[model samples]
Target: MHYCKEMLLIADEMRHFEGFSGALAVSNIEYMGTPNLREKQLSEFLIYSNEKEIVEQQQILFNTLWEKAIPAKQRIKEIELGIKREFAETIRDPTEIRKLFSKLLESAEKDILSISTPNTIKRIEKLGIINQIIKAANLGIKVRLLIDSHTFNEKINDKYGGELAQIKYHKLIKSLQSFVISMIVDESLLLVIDIKDESQENFEDSIGLATFTNIRSTLDIYLSLFEKGWHQSE
Candidate 1:
């Protein structure tokens, strides 16, 4: 019981500790379905203290792994500061961009602020982002949307009418002219896509290359723009 409990504890520790990737090697140990940790037959512990070759080989492997693993504390700091490397991925393909947007929305913890054109709104709704936005609102996540719509036309009003009151805040800024579609999650990750023309036959076909990043400076710029535009919108 003690040995089995120890292994389970180690696994839990590894989930929070990034500095180590560990494995337990038990000789001739076999199990079916859920392991019965109380079995007496699992008593023997393997030790290689006297085996020089086996110990030396394992030492080399351990050293290699330790060099490659990032420290748990360092990883925590990176996440807190929004400095993870994966946060800077550039997605160009239309399908992939939509997929990533959904993922970002799903993972958002606090809030979402977005600026969209009529075209982008339709595309995102078609891609199921509307449902995720509704879910986020239901979970108490603040959702603010600023649209470049001058009038309450059917294109922008009909689809989003039901959820307008559900979101934390939304504004219609018809005077703002822009071809860019931008979404920010929790004031951290930002996604921007440039549209060449809104009247294109396919939404995906009209999209140009875009990038997503959590860089602090870039985030500040987008936040400022959103705040300014939000204040000016009705």
Candidate 2:
């Protein structure tokens, strides 16, 4: 069975057409002056071409628009190739931040690494990030987590450590004094969360600013920092 629908760029000339099968008089505010399905005649009505010159002009316009509309895959390739701007943004919403985390996990092709506080790990647990990381690990992706040795009180740390011990790799930073969180995926994508408001014991209550970047050099710096912390933790 053939499944296809022909698209056309004739909205620009809808005003001059004389076809009365049916018409959707859209509000002027809603009109975007672009090709639209509603702009076409729903019935099998006929719209005779008034002149050859006008038809030729419309064809040219259609071809021009078609050339300018880039494919989604092509656009993504351009971004990955650094032809487009780097992915850099400050995120505040917890949901959006977790969503990006999930996306980063899914995008990882080789490894996933992170340096987070104990409370931040709990927040990530609440976000179900470890579950996704487990799935990624099952796919042969390496996973590494680095946390400050002073993340939690002895009781809480032991509990959390037991839970994380089931996972593959993790380390403790000896004097991990910073309250920052960083996750790097495949050495390509980097996420940095600054939890400067650590006065709040709960990670969720701590107001944090997040930055995401896909630049390799920026990610390398974070990876270097993670290495320093990793060695210190050992």
Candidate 3:
């Protein structure tokens, strides 16, 4: 259906072509119409109020929304080109972090690079995340893992021998005191887990915070560090 003549005329005449750029206060609400008002019935209705109180309230709401909104042109361009919105999220819940990690691994198309402490590795192994990594490797995804040398022992070898064999690359580096697990998927997404208490064996209890991001600049910084560590690893 075409827009009403009044709306079309206003859109054409306004200096701010986008509705959001104008000073006009607009409120949208759902409405049910009676039989007498059936022609005006709409699942959603826009309201323009002349009362000072209502206008002030709506202006405040509009300002709040405006601050959060991006330019309409940018949004339109993103939609047209099918661009994924960039985001960085800090996930505190262990379950949610695990879910995000698994989802990223499952969606990996080319490669996976990971740096992990032995304790962190062991914890995730218990959570079945290690199995997912092994599966990705089996599917021909390039998987490179870096772990500390001191903790890389007979026990870890015994547990991960078959699984590690399937991975494309594995290296041992000097012992790191920090309890952390970092993984980059397809050179796009990064997941970093900070371990609060290494003494705790469970993934939930040990992890302090998890950061997930696909921001290009952040990915580049980490990727450089990963490459440096990877080249230096044995």
Candidate 4:
């Protein structure tokens, strides 16, 4: 999906959520006369000298957003707008979808939750959500973690210490029996990440960033589907 240049540019800096906390002051709003560049101009005008809040630990910050995150109604509005933006208009590039994702994350303070089934620890680190949750919680936001418990239980052995954890088990037939549960963190974000590798990987695509849609709703839907599967399992 594509996002307009206006939202994209603002999203570039907003991705880290460090420089801008995604707070809208609502005063001093200005719209440039330029027909196409208004959104970009709008973000530029909402400059607050003291708009910097440094967070050391992110979990607590993320957890804070759970109850304190953007109002669900507002978030739904943003989602609707985002979807509208993707469908009604034409965008120059798809990479701009990343920017839209950034915007969604920005507006979603307490409403954000990530559900992930990591094939490797490196993959989890690559997703960069660990820090995302950490930061969200640090800000008094709520975040739920719904990882496949069996992965934690069998794939990783905390007792064995560091290096021994990398043992690869190819035949995962036993993995059909996995743990699944819904955890509500401060009534904010509900994470629904799956642990079982029931679905096959599509190795046909080579592009890295291409896989990301930057749509949280899409991810949320996927998490829901995973949960449904877990519920129906015998």
Per-candidate TM equals 0.59, 0.56, 0.69, 0.30
Mind giving the per-residue lDDT tens digits that candidate 2 earns over 126-214? 66666687778778888887864454334334655444443444455556547778889888788987886666655556647789888
lDDT (Cα, tens digit) per residue for candidate 4, span 50-111: 32332223334445544333443444456667742211122233335334333444455564
Q: Note the Cα lDDT for every prediction shown.
A: 0.69, 0.63, 0.71, 0.37
TM-score-best of 1 and 2 = 1
RMSD of each predicted structure: 9.7, 11.0, 7.2, 16.7
Better of 1 and 4 by lDDT: 1
Model 1 alpha-carbon drift over 4 Å, by segment: 1-87, 150-153, 168-176
User: Which of candidates 2 and 4 reaches a greater lDDT?
Assistant: 2
For model 3 the local lDDT of residue 42 reads 45
Superposition TM-score, candidate 4 onto the true structure? 0.30
Model 3 pairs in collision: none
Q: Rank the candidates by TM-score, best first.
A: 3, 1, 2, 4
Error of model 1, residue 28, in angstroms: 46
Per-residue alpha-carbon lDDT of candidate 1 for residues 1-234, written as tens digits (9 for 90 to 100): 344345555664322324332342322232112223234455333343335565556566556665655554455556778876434657778888767878989999999998887677666666667788888998889988887454324554576776655675445465554888888999989999888778764667768877899988999998998888788764
Arranged by lDDT with the best first, the candidates are 3, 1, 2, 4
Q: Which candidate, 1 or 3, would have the higher TM-score against the true structure? A: 3
The candidate that achieves the highest TM-score relative to the unseen native structure: 3
